[model samples]
Target: MTSARRTAVAAGVLFLITEVSAIAGLALYQPALTDAGYLGGAGADGRVLLGGLCELVLVAAVIGTAVTLYPVIRRRHESLALAHVAGRILEAALIAVGIVSVLSLVTLRQDGAAAGADEGALVAVGQVLVAVHDWTFLLGPSVVLGVNSLVLAYLVYRSELAPRPIAVLGLVGGPLVTASAVAVLFGLYGPAAHAISALPVFAWEVSFAVYLIAKGFKVFPVADRTVTAGGMRPELSVA
Candidate 1:
């Protein structure tokens, strides 16, 4: 396969990893995030620690998706491509912070129990940490993801990298997700409502990823060129 095709496959894999690891991490965190008695118990929950590892993977994959697509995307629009990369990096950083918050809960559990700290206070602190993680989730995955998704969809639409119909899904989805995030932030909507709003964006991403992996980029005029440091350059021909 050509370099562009290779980049597509790599990006698809990273997007898949980003979603899978995020779900796994969140599910694994339940024992710590949900169970109030967990932190007050004798020892730290291993699942929470494992969740942290999964989120670390998520962080890596999030950034990977941005950087992997940067060269191809920059060829179409350089400034927006830079914004996409920066946004993903910021999103990944927020995810890392959320991971740290969850992991700190585990630490609080172990040390608090060992030190004979008040159980009520410990649980309250755990709740605060979980809340921090939840806020980061709202900001990173909901708001930031939405903005970045919109930017990418616009790029793809303009470049004809994928079908315009698929890009439309993102065009619509991004604002919905962001608006829902704002609503949730202000208590106008719940997380469940936000999840429903996010479905379109999810559909857009999944469809895009699958298309890129299977069909590669659509037939375009730029096939003679190749990616370079910040943009694409014409292929060097050896005479």
Candidate 2:
């Protein structure tokens, strides 16, 4: 593969890392632990801390994808055909993280109240904010992640970089994600909804991670170069 193709693949891989990290560190692993309710007094505080740290990783992963792919995107602007797809996906990533932050703050207040650590006026306000944040937080990230997953899947398929099966996985991920988000919005919660929606998401993400690491970059020749040679033609140069 050419250098530009390599770079694009590299950027994609970086983006994939953040995707996997968010799902693994933030969504699946941490929640599994927290939901178990094993942390006790330290549970709330410790969970938040760990969650925050995981989010930082997510941020870094996002920034990494943006920066890494930016140059590649610029160079291949005519051919990428899905730059906006990446942008939408990134937006979803940020929203997912923001939702997590809001949820943590809400839970923090609740924890504080439980601990009798409430101050005067601040505590009362905190309690109110806690409820608002909690419910909103519950649904926001799910929807955001689901929407973005579909977008990413589209990008993957359109780009045609990875194997066809992986792209299919990405495509299937979209509806699964959408269903999960809708379920949550419609007052669905608990393990059943979580598992049904989340398993597909997790599967898609893990598959993407595997493809990025294993394949890295694959340069596929675009047809219709003759048409591309015309002024109106799409540029198909690699590297």
lDDT of 2 by residue, 1-239 (tens): 76655655666576666665566545533442334332223345555556556656766665565455444333344334355446445654554555464455546556655777635643455445444444433444455556656655565565555676776775776667667667666777664666576666667766766666567645443433444444565555642
Off by over 4 Å in 1: 42-44, 220-239
Worst 10 residues of 2 by lDDT: 32-41
Query: How would you encode candidate 1's per-residue C-alpha lDDT over 1-239 as one tens digit per residue?
Result: 88878988899888888888988999999888877688866544788899999999999999999999887877777899999999999999999999999999988988898899998899888889999999999999999999999999999898888899999999999999999999999999798889999999989988988998898877432425668797986652211
User: Which ranges of candidate 2 are over 4 A from the true structure?
Assistant: 1-16, 23-47, 66-141, 188-191, 220-232, 237-239
Q: What is each predicted model's overall lDDT from 0 to 1? A: 0.88, 0.54
The model with the greatest lDDT is 1
For candidate 1, the TM-score is 0.90
